[model samples]
Target: LHTGCIPPIVHRDIKTTNILLDQNFQAKLADFGLSRSFPTGNETHVSTVVAGTPGYLDPEYYRTNWLTEKSDIYSFGIVLLEIITNQPIIQQSREKPHIVEWVSFMIRKGDIRNIMDPNLHQNYDIGSVWKATEIAMSCVSPSSIGRPNMSRVANDLKECLISENSRTGESRDMESKSMEFSMGIYTEVIPKAR
Candidate 1:
């Protein structure tokens, strides 16, 4: 869900390519051409034509033609998965073509380590990685109602960062600054989507 507003705006398209990172690695979600806002407080969703990247589209929104903040959550979840695994969202030759399906299969096998990017060389904190994986999985839940709002995701990811920092013995000042930028990305950037 979009943050930093009472009536949150829904950015119907959210993907890794659209997420721009400045030199300092501060993230900014760009490309809001498909954004839509709930016209009234009582309305839960905006009925609109489904439009988004194939790999990142929210299945529920595509099926029902009902667009909501949860749709954005699903796309962002895919982004998270991409960040973790460094794998393409869809690989046709793979048995499980979709990234979510592949990740789920790997998780079922208890192979979290393999699911992570090989480039990491298992240098990350397992607890932190697990937490992030859980958050990403929840964001891609089949039911929109089951998915979390953006604030919760931001907070949970911040916890992951803190846990990772604790492992590496990073300074609290660095954590604070990183978290502040991260929070702005999740809370402020998406809401400004037109």
Candidate 2:
């Protein structure tokens, strides 16, 4: 999703383990061995054999063998769910069997607290967590076309980060810069500089 490449690359595999963080806590995508570029000129997807971790693989891509950038988004969503719930991607011992299903069930029952990682100790902004959960669910939509592009996802998350950091006394200037860049994504709920 680094927008630098001439032809956009689809990271066929994106899991929590493959995302590396540096000393500054910046995340970088790794393991490009399964990456593929979108076909040149107006082509939206590339036909290929499905090759990604089982729990994180995009169901549409696995079923159709037509890979798109959305496949990565789906995988990223799975990672986000894992981070939020701190649960295994798939656990046969659980009735839901998959993280998504468990999260969905919780949401249906209006249990946001259960969906959140307890390690957070109720320190984060609830609105920000709600927004992040919404974004993650959107990313995992069953249809590829239903997924937001990575830029949109990044912008939405930037808003969530801004909202959450605003509570911890991060500088207003940092919030301002991020808000300016992502104004359109979450204008309704973006917290004002205090």
RMSD of each: 6.4, 3.8
lDDT tens per residue, model 1, 171-193: 67654555654454343332110
lDDT, model 1, position 87 = 93
Candidate 1 least-lDDT 10 residues: 185-194
Q: Candidate 2: what lDDT? A: 0.84
lDDT of 2 by residue, 124-167 (tens): 88888887888899899999999987778877787778677789
